[model samples]
Target: MQTQLAVAAYIIHNNKVLLIHHQKLDLWLPVGGHIDQNETPDDALLREIREEVNLEVEILNKLDLPVEGKTKKNLALPFYTNVHSVGDHDHACFYYVCKVINPEKININQKEIKNFDWFTKEELNQKHISENVRNQALEAFKLFEKLTK
Candidate 1:
């Protein structure tokens, strides 16, 4: 199967995780998309978040490597990674946890997203939410709590 690299961010704010109702797939999912050429996973993730929700976000994952050279820069590591099918193709997705820099400035791109909302951990257990999304979101929330504390 053909596969593409992708990046996704589970943005948390005020103890809630952000989820978008994808128009094309008709499923509730985290904000993310295919990683473009010459773009790192972190770059793709931040760009996708900006394009989808018009909000700047700070990834909670961080690398503690010492700066050893001028050309080297620290990048946040993905919280999770997985391969999933999309039609006949598969995507190798790098998942990350993030926090909105300005939560009040959200403006969803209606062309791509059907709707967006902030969901509490309890809300993720709703019957409408897909099992994969709910589980990942709950994990993101747990990690976010641990990181912030």
Candidate 2:
């Protein structure tokens, strides 16, 4: 089975979360992508945020997920268990809480996504978001709320 390494971020601000409407999946998801061969998960995540949102973020380490073992550092991340889907390339995602650190306007690339939006938790929970994304958005929001409170 092929493995893929990836990193994701739950960008939060004022009880709102940023999500992208994926063109392929037709679902909203946090920003993320495959990790390059020479970079760390943190680096890959930051790069993905820049590519996806056109903004710089300050990653807060407090709410980040546990990293995979050091032995698997350079190994391909398995997607079977890391995500909701299996048989596809496996991936290990590093989820972090982040805030926009710069004031640049967003310029989303239309090739990978349809649109982007910032939604409150209330709107997300009551809307038609995918099950996986809904759960993730809720969890990320909960963690973020905890940190601020």
Candidate 3:
């Protein structure tokens, strides 16, 4: 398995979490992507945010996840958690908590993302959004609240 590093950013505003409807995966996920060969996870996340959401943010915290296990659809994840390993590809992703500096203006990546929305925790819980997505949003929100306070 080829090992690779990636990063994800959770951006929250007005008691709502920013989520993207991924075009390829056909699922809702936090904004993130693979880290480039020379880029740090932080750098990769910042670049991904700018590319995917057209916004800058301040990294609030670093979330460490050990790389192991196969991908599982945990009811408590935005995307499938656990490391991914295939024929020639393997990856472990780091998740980060960040606050969008500007929420009013966003440029969604049309190619990979179908739409973007800010959903309140309750609304998200009640919506048709996936259970995994809601769980991840809540986890990210809890982290945000704890760090910002």
Winning model by TM-score: 1
lDDT per model vs. reference: 0.92, 0.72, 0.76
Q: Give the per-residue lDDT digits (tens) of candidate 2, residues 1-149.
A: 67676777778876788888877767788888888998987678778888887878776543334567664433222111254342466666656777776635677868887998888987787565777777777877776676567
Candidate 1 vs. true structure, TM-score: 0.96
Using lDDT, rank the candidates from best to worst: 1, 3, 2
Per-residue lDDT tens digits for candidate 3, residues 22-133, read 8887777789888898676667888999999998887775344554588332211222244654236776877777888987679998998999888888878765688866
In the range 27-75, model 1's lDDT, one tens digit per residue, is 9999999999999888899999999999999988797778886847778
TM-score quality measure for candidate 2: 0.77
Q: Is candidate 1 or 2 superior in lDDT?
A: 1
Error of 1 at 80 (Å): 0.9
Candidate 3 local accuracy as lDDT? Answer: 0.76
Clashes of 3: 0
**Stretches of candidate 1 above 4 Å error?**
none
The segments of candidate 2 whose C-alpha lies over 4 angstroms from its true place after superposition are 62-81, 86-88
Report the candidate with higher lDDT, 2 versus 3: 3
Ranking the candidates on TM-score from highest down gives 1, 3, 2
Poorly placed runs, candidate 3 (over 4 Å): 1-3, 62-81, 84-90, 126-128
Clashes of each: 0, 4, 0
